[model samples]
Target: MGLSLRTSRFRGAVYFGSKNLLPRNLETMKTRKFLGISLSLIIINLAAIMERADENLLPAVYKEVSEAFSAGPSDLGYLTFVRNFVQGLASPVAGILAINYDRPTVLAIGTLCWALSTAAVGASKYFLQVAFWRAVNGFGLAIVIPALQSFIADSYKDGVRGAGFGFLNLVGTVGGIGGGAIATVMAGNDFWGVPGWRCAFIMMATLSCLIGFLVFQFVVDPRRISTDHDTGKISNREKLIDKSNTSSVTVWSESLAAMKSVMKVQTFQFIVLQGLVGSIPWTAIVFFTFWFELIGFDHNGAATLVSLFAAGCALGSFLGGVIADRLSQIYPHSGRIMCAQFSSFMGIPFSLFLLRVIPQNVSSYYIFAVTLFIMGLTISWCATATNGPMFAEVVPANHRTMIYAFDRAFEVSFSSFAAPVVGILSEKIYGYDPKSVDPLLGSTREAFALSRGLLAMMVVPFGLCSLFYTPLYWTFKQDRENARTASIKETEML
Candidate 1:
């Protein structure tokens, strides 16, 4: 009787233990799934906000500054330069900050800075003050972009990194589209006695601040994801085994070191040069509102057209990412260079045709719009596709932010120098008289002609930039082969 009772108790104990373990197992799985989804959502949201902010601030501010200060194309171009110049100076510093500090905290600070700077722009009574705040806003953006990109690269696996980047680009594009339309509507009509442009800035600032709060509260530091295994309580042998096998810290460090080592790679140097050249044309488009007005569009029309441009960019980014990812399977490192080359080639012809051959008839508006849309699609998508994958391949996941920041710094610094030079060249070489009117055709037509001519010159640099990428492709191929050989050797040894 005693033995039977003991056996029954043992069976009961086993049943209860299994039941308790089931819930705990389920809970662990649930937590992991939740974390994955949460991180993805956060990344998407952050991308959207960043893109939205960019689109919102530039178009509206250009219009407001031009109208208020009676500024010409050169003055407007200088303003664009100021924004990018500050970004150039700030990005590397931001990258260093990202390396040493908690990413979420750094990002939150950036977001707040963006909000306050934008708000200050809206409130500014002087042109210099507006320009100052715009620079401040650019500084904030410089901090945010690299940090967020690094987070995404660290969070996602290599196999799906392309898709992950694509999604991020897509979200950003969507946000940009929304932002453009919002800016257009707000600036097109006065809201509650506030100037339409002021309202736009206010709205952006409020949204930025709100998003910053969300990020600060809910975004977990990726560093925390591996801390449990990094605890000092583990034996040295066990730690060594883990380091050789499943340790995230070791992987992270290796990835970072690989990126830092890129300075030694000649291919990376060429890529950075290419990036700088590409940035020149990109900056022109960002300040395109000023160009548009010079080309005969009013503020409202320019805003609408900019919105269309943003839409094209959104579509292009998504398509480019998908195409680049597919091509990468076969060509590996060379795929991005090919995409960039094709795009650059297409841009030269398209831009030259638009500037040189297109007639100034009323119907030209429709034709130009279509052309701009196609240009927007191809340029934005192709640039993004090339940049995203190339950067990912060249740098380690952890060091991506630092490399990207430095890349942006170089790109922006050169581009900023180009902007003012472009402006001055237009004024001097193209015979642009901001005060003069062509009695027969009108001042607007004369301005448009000058702007078109200046934009045409930009195509030269962009086309020439393709040459830089060719050598980079070969270098990347060699690096990839070396890595593959090493990886195979390790597998065999194991």
Candidate 2:
């Protein structure tokens, strides 16, 4: 007899047969897709958006902030560094919590932390206060991101995992674009005597709190309702609940075990190795708005250019994932690595073209716009297309959160240095003077100097990132098969 799972729209009531079993392929089974796209997927996507928006909020208003605090690029860069470094260190907490609790709870807690921090940053009177809150914001993101990634991993099987992550990132980038654009435009005006940038953070915080509540109340953890893919059995559903109810000692112990298990995976090592170098370029790109402003673009003009680039990245990430998904089916061992290398390699030419080849002048607006859009399109594929889905396949289902968390910990911690490096390079080496920069009129000489620093950060890292993906060609297949064998063994044990 076919197993029947009946439920309301959101709160799933999964009914198993007399054997208390489900088909091995949950993707083909009907018990999946309980809430459709409305609740689970959409809410997760919204959560992704909320996180990205919070991330982009501070950097988006860098000019306003610089003037307000009389801070320079290096100081602003330190704020970002503090946030990312703290977030990276705290990321493993997500995995620990996920082991003991449902992902929804973990997400809710994360949202609460970030929402408070974002609001606090807006209210702070001193730069140090803002820096502290930004660090708190990073901690909150550290928790939310891994849960979100692992949730998608469990929701989609190996075959279409790339597309699933891509869709997640695609939606997330919208928030990044929107957050950055809105903040940039708003910084030019004041709302009810409050700075527009401050208002933006307050509004985002309120919305994030609401989204977190909705997620906690409505969205069901896919793990709670579905069987593990390879085993056709519930891996840790009951155990998760029991552990949550048990003492805290058990939770930490499980967390440590998961971390150890995740660290041993060779595929994960290679991916993290590449990500350490790969992420620096992205970190450095946070200066794009500041550079554009210095290059004579007004608020709307800068927002427009950045949004086009972000839109390109959003679409490119989805397309790359789709292409990788197709290629992986044909060449399971090496397709993702090849796609990743191609995507990372594209960054070199594009970075050189945007920062050096094109003249940094108001006359080149259309040219800059087109080039940025395409550069984003080509270079934004690595994470969604390869790293995420690849990480999912190398580890067991329960270890997903830990692997993602650790990856963020390693990659983000290393990449966080890029912001400060870029800032120092521009000011110390390239002769960028924050005091001389005119946010309104723009400064051509300072802009040129900043571009030189940006070029330095972007090109070499892109080259190294592409080279780092090579080792994955050998390790992926072996690791994937081992994971499969481990899953089968897990099924037998259960």
Candidate 3:
């Protein structure tokens, strides 16, 4: 949830957005204190979940949206493209804002944007308006998400970072699971005679507004704590200000420097590449509801399966972090990469093969649910947990948000284009001439073709991602040690 929220697509609002963290031994933190902090975190997480629910709800109401606007595959592609492209570019900008300004205030603005845009989306009548509001929603997320991730990273030590992040991701997945259920329930039910899809966005808008008020009024950003001021009232500056002795530097210049510093790392380069390659398939998983429908599941059934898959992803994310932490502690240098490599390799069969080749003579719909659950579990192992925290280990604390921003920007840039590409392929290359008709509920063959083609292309990324691990084995150990040394010096200076 902290970072993997965006990477997972549907749930990308923001987590506990922060500045610099006051770190303690999170593992051994007192039980009462932990519970108190957890309560705050839950409230903050609710805002993000509310903000992101509309995007997650899209799949369940896609047909309704499509019909309402007379949308083609390309039009749907445009909607995804607008939001994701803006999100990618906006991530680094959000990081820069977090570094220079107040995080909670920034998050407030973002939350307001999401809430307003969601309401606007519900009120919108045209496809262009829908796309516009969605893009606005994404921009809001870009601001909130980077801040949240940076804060979450700051709260914990490197040793337990994976587990902490895993917990965050698990919570996010739970939110997404809930979103799917909400979408299923709301898609057809009329509220005040309004369409279900519109109702979903309106509800999200209302929720985001309520949550935003709570966040603005009560959310205490950890990064604002400072040692120099009386009662620590003076705001904490970016770590780079102290490190580079450039307190006078402009926020833009500092952001550029941070971006350059993060990009200069060899190990980080490979890590980003691995994420980039792997996310190609991951981003497309949002479309699986259509596939499940193509195979015979009703909208509710498909949404149920999608939720099941999300649950698997949540459980897997937790287990992946626990395993990654254990392995890294035991084996050191190559352990995390090894686990990732295995996960990616194992993921290929379950994710791609199962998605591509439908099971023959399936006894029941439960088979589909069960298979998707297993697929979700295996496919999600490398999605977060180990790698995100690994970024903290290898990079300077000051530059962490920038690195996250860069990864978000880069991955979203590529993934934003995927929607259009898949749409084009479905229409031009392998399109089914007649839209498939479901006896229970009618479906477009074009949509089915789009799903099929997307599934086929997804197989390639899983294979390519497996090979990215080899380069990391050589560079990771040295980089981790150097980062440790740097962290020690930085701590001493503080």
lDDT of 3 at 134: 81
Q: Which candidate is the best by lDDT?
A: 2
RMSD in order of candidates = 5.6, 6.5, 12.1
lDDT winner between candidates 2 and 3: 2
lDDT by residue (tens digit), candidate 1, 127-218? 79878987988888788877777776666655556666767776786777666656755765677887887888888888888888777777
Model 3 clash pairs are 1-168, 1-169, 17-147, 17-148, 20-223, 435-445, 436-445
TM-score of each: 0.83, 0.92, 0.85
- Worst lDDT run of 10 residues, candidate 3, spans 13-22
- Candidate 1 matches the true fold with a TM-score of 0.83
* lDDT by residue for model 3 (1-494), tens: 74575565533323222211223333234543455456556766666566446567666566667667877556677777788889888888877876666566777888888789888988899888999988998898787777667666766777777777777777878878887678766875778889887888787788788877777776655554443334424433545334435454666787787787778877788877877777777666766765565555666777888899888888887788878888888887877787788778766677555655555222446776787788777667674555687777787776677777777888777778777676677778876443454434544454457666686657777788779868988888888788778767866775
Q: Hey, what RMSD does candidate 2 come out at?
A: 6.5
Q: How close is candidate 3 to the true structure, as a TM-score?
A: 0.85
Q: What ranking of all candidate models by TM-score puts the best one first?
A: 2, 3, 1
Output the better candidate (1/3) by TM-score: 3
